[model samples]
Target chain A: MQPAVSHGDRPRLPIQAILRQTQDLPVLPGAIMRVIQLTGNSDATSRAIADAIGMDQAVTAKVLRLANSSFYGLPRKVTSLQEAVILLGFRTVRLIAMVAGTFTWMTRPLKGYDLPPRQLMRHSMGLALGAQMIARIGQFDPEEAFVAGLLADIGKIAIDNCIDGKISLMMQLGIKGGMTFEDVERTVLGHTHSEIGAHMAENWNLPQEIVEGIRWHHNPLGSGNSWLAHAIHLADVLAMVTGYGLGGDGLQYQLCEESLEICRVSAEDFDGLVEQFVGAVLHGEALLEGMG
Target chain B: MDVRQWNLSFGSQSGGGLSSHQFSVGLAEIRVVNGPTLLECQGIGSCIAVIAYDAHACVSGVAHIILPKRLPSSSSDRPGTFMDTAVEYLLNELVKAGAVAERLKWAYAGGSDFVHLASGASLPALELGRRNSEAAKSELSRLGAEVVGNDTGGTTGRDVSFCTADGDVKVRTVHEGEKTICNLQ
Candidate 1:
């Protein structure tokens, strides 16, 4: 896609080129990647995944701590990594690892976006928890939706990096010009964080569903078979409204009515879910501190 | 100046980390601070933060308001959650804390229309920051509290701080650095 030719004389590059120009995008840790790969296999056992994760001493320690923390409230003292992994299940373990590995990137303050340190991470986890709840309401797999929501804004990091700390100017222009942050980026930079995030997700070799979730979260109607995407869209809107880890976007993005229809979410249901979602977000914060 | 330096001056005054004395005002919650303290309201998207200060009395408070008005059936005891009731609560609390009702000065922040589609676009279900701010202003006018200053409306979420000692209301956002919108002696 052609890059937006901002206000100045500087030549604008295409989105693909901008992605290539990014310096050292973070990657999943070897152990987490191995666990992700192993979990995808039907024959993979809990013991095998635990052994793979055990290779990373830091992650092993965090996962064990999280398992033992009151967040889980497991019946007994879980001594072994294998036992903790089994109790938490593969998806929860993977999320713990993902949160741990990406903690720094997720926690760093993004200029111009008005996100203080860990604000984006807080928002990401809030969205993840909200998405899980929405997915459960729809009887879908909450785990998959959780991961989708967690990484939906991964592109914002790259976009923030590419803009070279001039996001504040872009944000100011958007606010004065009556434009959404996504629209401002697309108009001046020729790409929104959503698309940039999708490229990063593809580079990381994440599942296609997750890739689409990141790409189309802002506009899920265009994405075919966007059940997961719709859940994320609602979760994001709800999170923003409730001020859960909110940042520069604030309440500026458009809420897609189609997403509500496709996802079958009612206003009444949304209200009820919000109360539970808030508690879940607070609980998730405790888990987040443990991950760090 | 950058936020860090501005924060540092406060840090030196108190001889502690900024986070130590900082308190967040949640939805509908009102926190009254009488000593040298930095009462904060973080990440206000469409919501409004109503800050009232009486410097002479050294009594100040912040209310994080989520909605524009309070419904008749609204049963939440925290009056600060609604614009209509927030000013009343602030006035009452200030008087109880030794602040003269006629001496109160108010400052507003964080009513942003970050999502309005266009200048003349049809209204969405909620105008959010705009409505909350308007309601607060109208109610404050009715109660006869002088609104000293405000940095309301824009697309960015603001982290606001009101220090009780000097009644300095500092507004910080990503688009704009830290600026003291309201400074009272």
Candidate 2:
């Protein structure tokens, strides 16, 4: 339903619904999923992971060459995947997989949403990285946190495909309300990204934690499930503040008190997280470009 | 200065005898068949440029644009066509002109972040110029081409020229009473 208010004012909904409407979400690009499956301590050996990578020679070569590029800021050039993993680490590699494999899909022009690919990629990666920092500060599973952060807005693609003209309309309302894209999602789509993403998770049969992470990412204040969601919520906001990955939602963020309580993540701690997250993401940029 | 010694040339859709590879930022697509060519457009506030060159053929092409993808200046909805499509088209033309994909030297200019100072039409929360630059860079990267020169960003306007014969490009900025050469080193 249209928000029917005059253009000067319109309703903004939560992000859950926006997450509900993703179209052609970039899959984990088989090899990346394979790496995730193989990298476990028990499932496979480094040789196995190497074999899987070697099978897709193109992505592997690209990742290795990228890893060796100036992005890593390595004092010495790394010529092999083993060296890349040793240097960039497995967790970083996983994050890179998620980004490199998926970022391009985000680049598809969202006419209904009026968002270019680069806009969404920057926003999504910024929040994902921000969440990882917050989770690390709180001693939660940072890897899970990063994944949660990355998938926080999976519902947006769905929204763009489902709501016809609403995305662009919401974009206009967003500016009027001083609201972010998420707010527009809520207004136009009725729910928020967290809810939409949560539902998507349920459909995809994603792990229970990821589903909850999607649901509570924006409203972390009242979350009873995991600190990862709250951490991601904070990171999303922080990314906007730092000008890292800005979306339709700019600095019009109102801190979710309940989410803050759920994580017990302090302001001082958050400040530190932002500082460190910036450094890590900056370093990670090269790694993401050169996945191994 | 687009006519200076071994420095510059302007090109458009029609063939020009100026320098073998001079650049033209004017909205016309210019073609050159001899030596090299540099075509350009400048002073783009929220505009982007396309650079397609054949290193083997020693020829380069450029286009300056104002949107991400192309849409009608009137009412056609082509949101997925702008500097990106223009670059792709130019590149395809270069290939037809006997330019190798990997040998093209590429660069661009004229995008500035616009935070609309005045309230006129409803403005979305978009960094149009930044978006344009990103699209251009992404297309170039995908094609294995890197921007060798650029003078992007800021509130000031830009003017640029390209030399096809030698692949020399110049970018100038309008600041106060002087037009300063803005270099991206």
Candidate 3:
């Protein structure tokens, strides 16, 4: 489908420029980071991870509630972090940390950019889920892919914070400036979100690949075709197209040649990926309907 | 602390590049010239680094480039002027710095071509990282510099530092010992 150009040709806001912001969407809250570390570490134990989860009252509450919630439908109340970890495996436990981390961030509002509190959260969580499907399809570590996809646009949140209400000004500049929003940011802000994110990654001590993925998702070209950068880039766009949670990115869909080539994404596959994602999101949304 | 002699890390196929360090991003002034020595770029992941060291003269140079190719319109970030480009470019810089291409030894670090091989569009093959390695290798061979050592592939991130004044190259991953990417005989 073609991108609809509105009357007056409303200038495109870069739904993507979030990729070029000055820093990472603030580091995962420290507690969440600890959980992520434990989940990713092979030496970490269920008890240890469970202990870590138990530290966050919110997550601890979520685990117990979800385990007993209608979703699991156990005969009796499943008590303790030990039971939750035993039932959920390390992989599932890691996923929980990711969700908890995601919730902590997505719950906030990214004003000046037009994303209502839950709007960006819904979009971010949706992308994260869809990215996992892509990872599974391609046979990589789906969980890690989910994290990559989930945090891909973290840079955008920075732009909203840095520029304030000027997001509208930047949006106007995007189409009129004949710039891909990135040009406008560089022109106004001196650096793009990608650089900011890479900078943020260094500051927050995130793994280089995750930082790279965040920095280059918008312009896969600069990332130099490193598979992690390229795959995550494509996953980001694909998730957007599927309409999982469209954010403030101006809905621009001019695909990058290098990213498409590296992902081997054809017209058919592109459409297929979107359809598959839309379905996946629908399934997840349905299952978690009762909960926020 | 194990006070081993200084070593270095270079690159061929790679995943990431120089992430953690006290060095400045615009810290663009140091250039290697003459001697049997080492060169380095630390905090490397998927990206590849290219090293050219002339052990006989105790001179060396190291470069770290992030991608397989630059964007079509990215004339600003020239591939030939980047990390690997700088490594290969060192030959000319070395000639000026008082060293010959034949006298130089080479090393590489931080490449895992298959780290995320799940994007299965494999016609071009799931070998972006290896292809990068191959590209760097071809360029080095063309320059007549002898490749003395390498640490590429497998899922690991490496930190590399080199000293051209003494012909040393050092590679450090999370748990692995510092191996010299350039162990020129």
Q: Each prediction's DockQ?
A: 0.31, 0.03, 0.01
How does candidate 2 score on lDDT?
Answer: 0.55
Q: Write the per-residue lDDT of candidate 3 for residues A26-136, one digit (tens) a residue.
A: 666565667777877889988888888888788776666655555445677878877877876777666656666566566566664445455466666665676677666
User: What local lDDT score does residue B118 receive in model 2, on the 0 to 100 scale?
Assistant: 21
Q: lDDT rank, highest first?
A: 1, 2, 3
Per-residue error for A198 in candidate 3, Å, reads 3.8
Ranking 2 against 3 by DockQ, winner: 2
lDDT of 2 by residue, A241-279 (tens): 334433333313445544555556654344344335545
Cα deviation at A20, candidate 1, in Å, is 4.4
Instruction: Kindly give the stretch of ten consecutive residues in candidate 1 chain A with the minimal lDDT sum.
Output: A1-10
Fnat: each model in turn: 0.39, 0.00, 0.00
- What's the i-RMS of each model? 6.3, 16.6, 18.4
B1-185, model 3: which lDDT tens digit per residue? 11122221132212223333212111112346453333455434445666666656655555664444433333333333234455556567766776666676777665443222122233333333465567667766766667777776643345566654444556754334356555553
Which candidate model has the greater TM-score, 1 or 3? 1
For candidate 2, lDDT tens digit of each residue in B139-177? 777777756766566433344665554455565432222
DockQ of 2: 0.03
What does the TM-score come to for chain B in model 2? 0.68
Q: Rank the models by DockQ, top first.
A: 1, 2, 3
Better of 1 and 2 by DockQ: 1
Error of 2 at A18 (Å): 10
